[model samples]
Target: MTNSPDILSNTFPDTPQRRLLLDFVADEADALQRGEQGGFWPDNHHLISPLIGKAGKFLDEDEHVAFFHHLLRLDHCPPVKTEEDFALLLRAYDGLGDLMSRGYPVCSLPFHLAVFLFGGDALARLPAEPEPTLASFQSGVSFLRYARSFAHMPGIMSKRQKFIDLSADRALVARVRKTLLHGHQQLLDGLGRLWLWAFVFLVLQVEEEAQPVIRKIREDAAAAGDVKRVETLERFIAAAGLAR
Candidate 1:
């Protein structure tokens, strides 16, 4: 295949590539259920392995498609402007997040997810919105709840990760498993906080320009008696401001 697997390029993640990513997501899940010894994530160090396996490493077609395609989907993201025709970029974002939660190597995506989900002109249509719909506010709160699980999720110990994580730290990532399982609550909490800081940060990318949207989401959570959500959103607002 001439495709280099580098996302955000003119030559990658065309419709077929996008479909391939989605298909392999399901395939990984199914592969886990039946219990393949190593599952499909490449034994290679990177989350997405290279097309031609070097030395003695090997990559199956499904493993190559699912993981690399995921990166492609992530790079293009909920389609914005003259960016490749990724009209489904936000949906693509969600798919990428789902994959991360499943322990695919995320490299720096967590950081990108936290800070740049709507980078550039991705949200170009929203600057003049009259008001967020009830649905929009609800989705905001829901996303925080969805992302919160990773705060403490070890996301480790996969047979797949043990091989890779051992090097990366899932096998230790498998090793990480050994540490976390034996470690105390304080360690878990600290780890959770870092992951949450990254994971849920995307729950609300509340830059000052985006504060109105965050305010509405916070307001809705408050009115609905969601003390936890109200407090969290307030913190996100403060954190966003501080980061500046």
Candidate 2:
């Protein structure tokens, strides 16, 4: 991600709200596609960070938090040109969630992938199924883990069931888990890097237009000894004409 203008924006066309939904979708898809092809896509991931920063800014200052809230929710999908496409994506996510909740097997793999990548609200409704493909299986495990963590994040007060051994398909879960635990670290790292790149762009831009919240992020990062956020903070400060 090179902080290119091509990746900027905060809303999908046709949606009621202004969100960088397309940029987000593009980044996530880049991660997965890169994982499949044995690499990373910096440009794809770089496209969304400013939007994330914008969402953060709006969340801090805008009275209409719903729009920004929705923007933050778009981490699941890669970028799309229109909200109509996003609506289809939403349906797939909801359908997949319902399928997972019913304890169906790998037949619902596409839906699972769609939901996790697209940030549709209905993922919690899906039943767990162990898809056989290398990508799907690994993604399934990661999805559950992330979902569990997301459930615990601030402002996400959903009562979805945590992923436990359902006993219905322990063998599959165990098999996929073993595989993912062994060689999937790169994928995770790539995803994190993608997000980091975007965050860098966000912090750099937002601090100039919206300072207070970015300052708070810096302070919190300092208190927590969160070295990883340093790059983002630096970019923001520099961009804001504050200091590196």
Candidate 3:
């Protein structure tokens, strides 16, 4: 999770974009060294804090990094507190978003993650989504402004089903909600699971496919008599508005 040059070089193969990302990461790490930024924190991922040194690039690699690492394959990042912090993180993600689109052109998770991180209202107030502020990104991200983005990248196309649930992501959320539950569950970290869960319940807001999966997990917990787990699931379901 540390922002060592090694992690950057190893993550990106392209020398050009790699340099851009490395520079961005270095700036972020330096920002962390300077001081704290300010803002309201969301309950989810409202958890990470400023680190001591060049650690993990700025913030530690938390459960959220799992998705960024495994799917986009670099697999990592975190949230911000103030407008400055939000802009700093947003700038890095902009590099990530553009870096990711170097080959492909239509991915939107970078923009979506930005909105999710800064809160929809903050993004809404902007003149426009500053997502790929890079000139190379010809396509502005889909913000639900036009359509949903499937991310149409490696994880979905990996040969071995690298991320089982993620491998099912065919760039279509509805299709994902329809088919993802059928895939066998694997070792997604807590945030990974939370992201996938939220992807279904919150984004699609449909109960058809999500209900069965929720039932299966709840059933498994009940069968094992894991009272804590069952309670946790109920609380999550209720809070996420998963249950009707």
Candidate 4:
């Protein structure tokens, strides 16, 4: 497991390329916040693509860790102006997600934070009645599912719950519930249940509101003889002080 404090304190070596990329990220963020158009936006793909390609070529684990941390830190600037700006913010996250999905030895904490940050930005850029397309919702859910491997790690569960707390609105949560209910039956198994539980308990927050879905998941786990999953749901219910 990666030490959060160590990652936080780590910084990349001061090189011309590194300095240029960092400056571009800050400048682009400022330009976007000022609602400027067409200045360096067109150069984003050219500039960021090479960094993504070289991101994994660091000399050591410490360098690798610092690289990702630096990229994620760029997202701390002011809010973006357009979908293009949002896409720029997600470049590092998308690269990290791709790395993890390819079975790289990336730390789950940074990856999870990247996913959550990207998802928040993506949702913010959406219209009020955004379409429930797979692209629109899957990034957040997929990241939550991926983070399950580290669920037992300290602070992971609360972070998962916090992501739900931060990203969920009524329409988004309802759409997620509907998606999980209709065809994504696989999401109810194992750590997926934890994802569901977080959504139900943290996002939905009312026992009455959550009971039906919780009961269905519990019964499904029982029938499938998934004792661990059944216990997980029960513990969630008990934690919430909801009547069985």
List per-prediction Cα lDDT, in the order shown: 0.33, 0.34, 0.35, 0.43
* Per-residue accuracy of model 4 over 4-71 as CA lDDT, tens digit each: 22322236565655554444544444443343322442456466556643543322343433343334
Stretches of model 3 off by over 4 angstroms after superposition: 1-71, 76-173, 176-182, 187-193, 223-225, 236-244
Per-model RMSD to reference: 16.6, 20.2, 16.9, 14.3
User: TM-score for every candidate vs. truth?
Assistant: 0.29, 0.26, 0.29, 0.38
The order by descending lDDT is 4, 3, 2, 1
lDDT of 4: 0.43
lDDT of 3 by residue, 59-139 (tens): 334312321322221233432333433344444443343333322222223323333333222213222223322221212
Candidate that scores best on lDDT? 4
Query: How many times do residue backbones clash in model 3?
Result: 9
Write model 2 residue lDDT over 1-244, tens digit each, in one string. 1121233334323332233443343343443333321122244436444454344332222211322222223323423233433343343344333333322221223332333333222423223433233344344445444443432212121221222222134443333223222221222322233322222232233323225434544665567676676555564355435544
Regions of candidate 2 where Cα sits further than 4 Å from its true position: 1-85, 94-192, 206-209
Clashing pairs in 3: 1-56, 2-56, 3-57, 38-81, 38-82, 68-75, 69-74, 69-75, 150-171
Q: How much is the lDDT of residue 223 in candidate 3?
A: 68
Between the candidate structures 2 and 3, which one is better when assessed by lDDT? 3
Q: Candidate 4: misplaced stretches above 4 Å? A: 1-129, 132-150, 153-168, 190-197
How does model 1 fare in lDDT? 0.33
